[model samples]
Target: MILIKFLFITAILYLGPVVGQQECVKKFMDLSLVKYRAQNIGTESMTGQFMASYTLRVLWEYQFNCSCVNITSLILGINIRRVTDSRRLFPSVQVFTPKGSQYNLVTGSERIIYYTTSNVSTNGMIEYPLDPPIKVTNGDVLAISQPFKKASVVRVYYINGINFSSSMEYHIGSKNIDTSNFLVSNELILVYPVTSGYCVNSTNSITAEFVKKKALEIQRSQPFYYLSQYIYPQIVFSCNGSVTKWIFGAYSMGSLSRPELQIWRQLGPNNYNKIGSSLINATKMIGSNLYEFIPEVPLQFQEGDMFGVYSNNMVNGDSLILYEQRESGPMNLRIGPRLVSPLSTISFLKLYQFTNDYPLVTVEISQSTDLEESSTTEYSGSPYPSQLISKPSQSLSVSAKWLIGGIIGAITIISLASILVLACIIVFIKKRVNLHNSTDYSIIDTRKDDTKKDDTKQDDTLIMNDMTSVTPMQDNSAYGSTHDAAVNENPAYDSYSDGTYLYMSNNLYATVDEVKQDQDDDQYI
Candidate 1:
């Protein structure tokens, strides 16, 4: 029983750390901090110790663990050593292609050879990506080396392929220098230092005077002729170098302004080799310090983040409450490019109002008199705190005006469209009514004219037949009188065969008939 208990305890202790480490690895992988953290490990020189270990495939998979083994606040820069040896020669011997015919080796017998050093510790050999794979040994002809340094007299050379037998003897001065086996080429190359600047020192506490002195010294070192003789004539620092030394040595002279401290904090006692290092440092330092007064929340802002300020006691007409989220964290609000101080409450309120009463604010942490123990303070607010106030952007009024104008324009367009549509509808209705009225008139006129024309034609035919019958009875006076009486009965027919009268009457009748026919055709079709 005792042995089993001991084994169980041992297993628990052993597995606990393994499980925790696995969890850490999982978190790091999910975060993608491997590459990001590795890049920041050693900015200038490899000071921070980092080790990554991959657990070999056990049952089915592989796992890894990456961690920082050591942490230091200081990063130092190391200078690169240049090639100083003098025995090396320049420009390898150039040999023309072998031919039976005689050819002169013109103007290339004697030449200067130069060499250059690379920051990479290896022989500076980078393998090329091959298209068609070529079978070669590991120690194959990688690339031809160039001169390590260059002078007015020095030059460079290149050779392809490795010397297999007698590799050492094949160097510079050898009897059997098989130049035929190696392909030779040469070109001029430029060399620059890997590192141009170095960090001198780092401390948590730095005075403001030291920074100003350094700045002044840098100004003095600039072109003196340009400073004194030409422009900036009022500048008179006769003992410029000596004065700089005394001012810098004092270390107790410059002002401890907010901007200067912010600059130092951003530098963060770390190595900075890349460009914009100073600006980055300044921003970071100021931002981190500002975070103390600014509340931490998921600031839903794109034009940088947002921070707020608060003061229980404030003076009138003083710029006090000032806040801005310049970067990721809260920053001191700027009034026309000048930083507002926290002590000035009135300015803070004005700036706050200017920024639309941004409500994300933090409380002033109370100081503890006892230094030995830590204390936690509670405030009367929700988990996620905020000081809400109503103040919309001034631009919102302009936006509202634009919105109203758009609405008005849309309404006007719709009204005009409706009026046009109504007019078109009325015109269409009027045209339809006119067409119906014209058709009615044509039908009435055609019916009346048709009856009159039929009656006239019958009358004319009857008259002709009567006249022929009466010619046989020319002497009969009774028959002639009877015909005359019948004609007189219908006195409306003044002429039965008058061509002018008949033509006029027939044309009027034909016009009426044609109109009626057109109406009928329209209905049929």
Candidate 2:
């Protein structure tokens, strides 16, 4: 048992890192440290003409919530417009560490680590994957910057006053020059290698408990470039539920006094009454541009009520709230683009409630026994409550479908090729058989002609033997005279007398009559 325990401990020691790595991979696939939704509501380009030496830079900072297991890549949304075919642009990414205060513009170590160049025309969000991943840990201050070198118009999606707590800062300048936060917008940039391989220790942490829901609504508004000393924009939202918390994004100068966040409820169309008021305080700044405002006391709101957050600051400075001109609010107070607009257009806000109560049901039951004893019981609520269903299985991805189709297509092509080869083989076999049959017929005809010639030669040989017999018998005089007389007296001999002739040793003689007479006499004998 001691040996087994030792072996088991050793196994765990060896497998712990492996299991951690697997969990890290899963976390990387599902989590993101920073993400900003891109919008095409507006675009900013280089104000002047294109110059090869000219460079534009934008800086942003992000704060991580958890210790990063690994940082594999960085993604930024870029828009390239009116780019010519012959023109090209090289965009480089730089990361830095903050040097001084978290809310100030101080940077320390800098690295020009990643760079990419593109010539293809692109209009909207384009992703650039970093080759070498950056490693980071918890609470690491990350400052990211992008420098573009080209004549083409390039735009990055941004929100105005999106980061107010100084968590994010933007600076624009020439290449290798110090940047300033003059006209910088909150850029949509993201870093990878999110929280993984870590378990949540507590869900009731201060930040998690306060913010239960993510920002639900984002209204896109134009950047408020001009600042007025006594005027501020009012933002209205139609909301429901007893709001326990309110968050707003804005941009302000650090020297300005705290602004008042006024909550208003709509009585009728274009009529709003102030309901609740809270002094705006910066909770957290996501990036250099976005600022968060959380009320001290949770404001309660009814259903279908038009609510609004109005900034009461009356100072004209570089600090201004960003809003879009889109038609989104249910009611409007100001008619035109006055000093104080009725509604600030594009803003990000979240509403949360801490306690939500459900209705209760009670039941009572009474039972009586045959022996006259009775009992009463009470039941409340549910014995078995329904749980939320798990998510359905995901369908096959595009790459998987393409792979299956390619395999099927290859099989079909092979089948067609095989059938074509088989047909060619069959046709060749038939042609060979036809050629062989024609050759056999020619051989048979030659053999028949040779046989006929042999029979004719045999007949000619028999005739020659008869002629020789006549010549040999000519030496016998008595026999020859009697044979001659016999041949001439025969009536058959007359048949040969007209043309029968014999030639021997250059001398010609008419012996056909004798020959015919001899033949007739021989037959009779």
Candidate 3:
């Protein structure tokens, strides 16, 4: 019961008396983009009266909901009105039943509908009604469909008094909107533009005239073709040196029209800074903080920025090409060590082409500030018009030589470092060996006295011999004090026994003592 009540209330909200009285506003709008063809509106024919003007093709779609519960019959009408003016633009008598789809629609269907074209005669209003309202609820969808009818397109007329170069503004609806208060975070404003001119010398009037004539001749040789894309001319602004954002727009032409537009951010402090870095010579500053890291303008532009049709797969065509400068005007666009302009500004242009066998096309930029004048030699090997080939192999070989030389130098330095380290290690080992040899100690002990000493001490030697001989025949009790006293006389002797003898004056005896002590400690632990 609650759901039914809610549906009833929603139906009233959508189809109330107030809403029924007013027409539904459309949501979609589109404008066609045309290429660089001269406007046909003003071109005069041999007849001299006037030319048939062109129309701007437009497309739009609108949606509506149907909600009628248990209804048997009803009539509905639709009206089309220009948003700028409240007046309707189609006939009012013609009506239509909301169509479901192109395939689902047929003749004699009860829910079928029809419509009429611009009834500007009737103040531009179109209306249609449903014969019987098919049982529909709050969720039922109703769609009205039809092709573009008469006067649906915007008419372009030739007016002798009107100017072709002036700007025009059109609104989708005349409803007043407060866009002035809307905040814009990023925006681009073109300040100044660069123009084409030739250098003049005061001393030679004929030479200057000849140069101008040659320029004009070149222009004549390549007839100008109006391009479709909008181009933003190169702008040079005298900023307070605090501007942190900009945008670069360019286009690709040829068989594949892959147009690319980018908004590059100038790197700097995240928050705005009052003072910027000092300026330097205006060479391209790559991988720096002042080059790419800021907000950019949001809009589409067109002018004459043209480039080659970049073709990689199909290698037989000439590509559309554009130029960018790596330098700036007289004063370097930098602050301290930070550079302002790194990648060059894009320059879109219009130029002609030659046949496949034509000579290498050379592009040169004359020096104006810190950058020296330089030229690029481009070759066209074949007749394919959309591809850009690299420079000759001979140039690449020259560059490769320098790269190889640097690599070799780096390797040599690393090798020398390794050798120095190895020499130091060898010296350290030799010093360690010398230290061990100088500290080494050994003991020499005599087991027997010399015969000469015995001869000199004949009385004492006889007594010693007599005692040794008696000890060999003595019992345990008799030899106990004597043998103990004899062993004590040799303070270096650790153990002594009469029947067995063993010598242990080497380091192995000390090692065995240490192992035995460790075993005793392990058992205690």
Candidate 4:
């Protein structure tokens, strides 16, 4: 009897928590699982625009009987492509209790229950967590208000083909929302915590395995053509799970006609089949003009499967420009062929993907173990070879080497050009100084020659006067003696052609005979 009692107690102890946990988990799942969601069918259907400084209020009627429920988060379906910067797209979220006839106020008092800000990273439906999760009872009318700031525009999807006869209440910037003809639910999702008991955990506790699949890391080469015609740039990737979302870069000349984006699966080498297509709205583009595509249903791709993007909207011979990497270098693991025509495949395109599992985690985690062993067991033996997903580190190393080489070459060229210019300037200045000195020397030499010529002419004239006066003096001795004496006494006296000897002192003149007589009288005295 003791043994039986012991077994019974042991069984109860083991099964009690397990049974309780299962029940608790179910309750939590029912509570936390998304109850009401406005779904978007395709990218083309999202045409509603929410501008900045305007508050968009969406009314949700609670129909559950859980007594008291916890609101965990809010999921907003937004087109991120319209924003210039995803980081700048901040909108304040508020939960309110609806008032009477006025849809703007929750109650007559307009009481706010919960408030938080949304952090948007990518273009798609994003989940915003609420701190101190809101608690609500049954039959409560809840309003989700999103106030957009200045310069913030969000593209929202609306439920198509539904008519509202004043029963549904929604407001845009203090104005009554009228979807009188068709029913439109601006895709707003509310999240709740499913389990209430200690054994149950919230859904947010579970972490998802994220994988990134990139086509090419580097930009493609030149010879790019503006795709005025239908051109499909496809990227081939092998993923086992469903593709939730995709992002790609594009250049638009802002044509009136909308461009169409299509996805295709590869059946064989160079053969592809269309899966889904969407009309890309140019007005809803974000940073770098990248567009995000989220299908109504997640598209699943098997292992070693190939996918491509077909873009069509070439009006007035407008081309969809693409960068093509022509040179042979390290190719991306997800890189595929550039299908120009039905029979032509010579170039490559740039593309990337986010998968359910890490593409390079296996390659990164198994460096210590043997390559063969690691390849077979790592990350559940990902079908892709390590060489494929492993970032062409070797190629990157080589490319880095080339990049450094190119930089060095550029620096060298600039330095050489600078030195050549400096040298040329120096030579020019030296030549200018030399020419100036030569000019100065020529001027000095010319001045010296002119002075020497003047001196030579003066000496010649004095010699001619002395020779002519010598013959005349010999013919007249007495007169010549008197004249010589007078000339000696009055050194300033001069004999003119009129035969008058004049003595000049300062500005006064006297006869030479008078000057000689005065000199003789002074000698006698």
Which digits, one per residue and each the tens of the lDDT, describe model 4 over residues 334-436?
Answer: 2222322221221212222111100000000001111111111111122122222221112222223444455655565666668779978997797677545
TM-score result, candidate 3: 0.15
lDDT tens readout by residue for model 3, 150-269: 222111111232111211111222112222222221111000010122211111122323322222111101111112111111111111012232211112133332212221211111
The regions of model 4 sitting more than 4 angstroms off are 1-53, 61-64, 81-89, 98-125, 148-150, 153-155, 163-525
Instruction: List TM-score per model, in order.
Output: 0.18, 0.22, 0.15, 0.26
To one decimal, what is the Cα RMSD in angstroms of model 2 from the true structure?
48.9
lDDT of 1 by residue, 339-383 (tens): 233221222212210111111122221111121222222212211
Model 3 ranges with Cα > 4 A deviation: 1-224, 227-410, 436-525
State in Å the error of residue 197, model 3: 31
For residues 402-478, could you state the per-residue lDDT of candidate 2 as single tens digits?
44445655565666668778978997787677445433211123434555543323211222222332223233242
Which candidate should be chosen as best, given TM-score against the real structure?
4
Go through the candidates in order and give the clash count of each: 22, 21, 42, 21
What lDDT score is found at residue 500 in candidate 2? 16
Off by over 4 Å in 1: 1-341, 344-396, 442-525
